[model samples]
Target: MECKNDYLCEKQINMDKLFEYSNRLIKETDTKFFRYMYDEINWKNRMIGLIGPRGVGKTTLVLQYIKQNLNPSETLYVTAEDFYFVDNRFTDLADTFVKYGGKYLFIDEIHYPNLNKIQTFPYNSLINSYSLSCQF
Candidate 1:
């Protein structure tokens, strides 16, 4: 099923662009260099958040997992700092992705979005509504 909303289509385009960027990064990432936390993280969880200082390899870990485990068509990797978020809402991206059958959404740099603007139920409701698994 495809969305008819032009705005959502625009968001889908942004998502495709992000996927292209993420694929390049994932291709460059060396899976042999595994982090301790990578083994510690339970990839089966509905939602996961990795919090730590910069250069901690969190993004690389997620990218590696996507490369090794998840199917590309079922997953999406996006960053909060991406220009797409400047005009589009995160929820809108989630909605469009799910509509098109995305299952796992990995968001890098999760802290960049304004918590106040995102408001309540954005996370919990999103999971309940779409059954989308997110990693940050």
Candidate 2:
């Protein structure tokens, strides 16, 4: 996808060749769930919050939607538990990512306490975090 800031953006490298092979069963099952949610969601201009007990497949549902609808290059999947996140600032990563054309960010385990303080990061990037947390 083309971005306004060419200097900040670079070509996306699809390192995971696995994305090419369409898994019929996974797609079908994910689609069924997406369809159900689609019927329930008004995606036009609303934020969606998916909450449930652990291991109930909430993350699976988000990943499935991103896989089916968006190019992998335009998205970034991150988890608060990631080692890199321990010492890294979410705002810094988000600024670098968005300034480079990132569109969707799928963050898991965001209920972590570290992220709670990130809502006060002095940057536009924290807006998404706050919005997302509020939605949650």
Clashing pairs in 2: none
Tens-place lDDT digits, model 1, residues 6-75: 9666666776787788677767878988888878988887777676666778788888888899888788
Best by lDDT: 1
Q: Which ten residues in a row have the lowest lDDT in candidate 2?
A: 127-136
Query: Which candidate has the top score in TM-score?
Result: 1
Q: Name model 2 segments beyond 4 Å from true.
A: 1-35, 44-47, 113-118, 121-136
**Every model's Cα RMSD, please?**
5.1, 7.1
Query: Each candidate's lDDT (Cα)?
Result: 0.70, 0.47
Task: Write the residue-wise lDDT of candidate 2 on 1-136 in tens digits.
Answer: 3544643243222212212222322344455455355446443332444555677666666667665666565566666565556655556556555655666655566654344345544322332231231111
lDDT of 1 at 45: 77
Candidate 2: Cα lDDT at 16 = 24
Using all chains and alpha carbons, the TM-scores for the candidates as numbered come to 0.78, 0.56
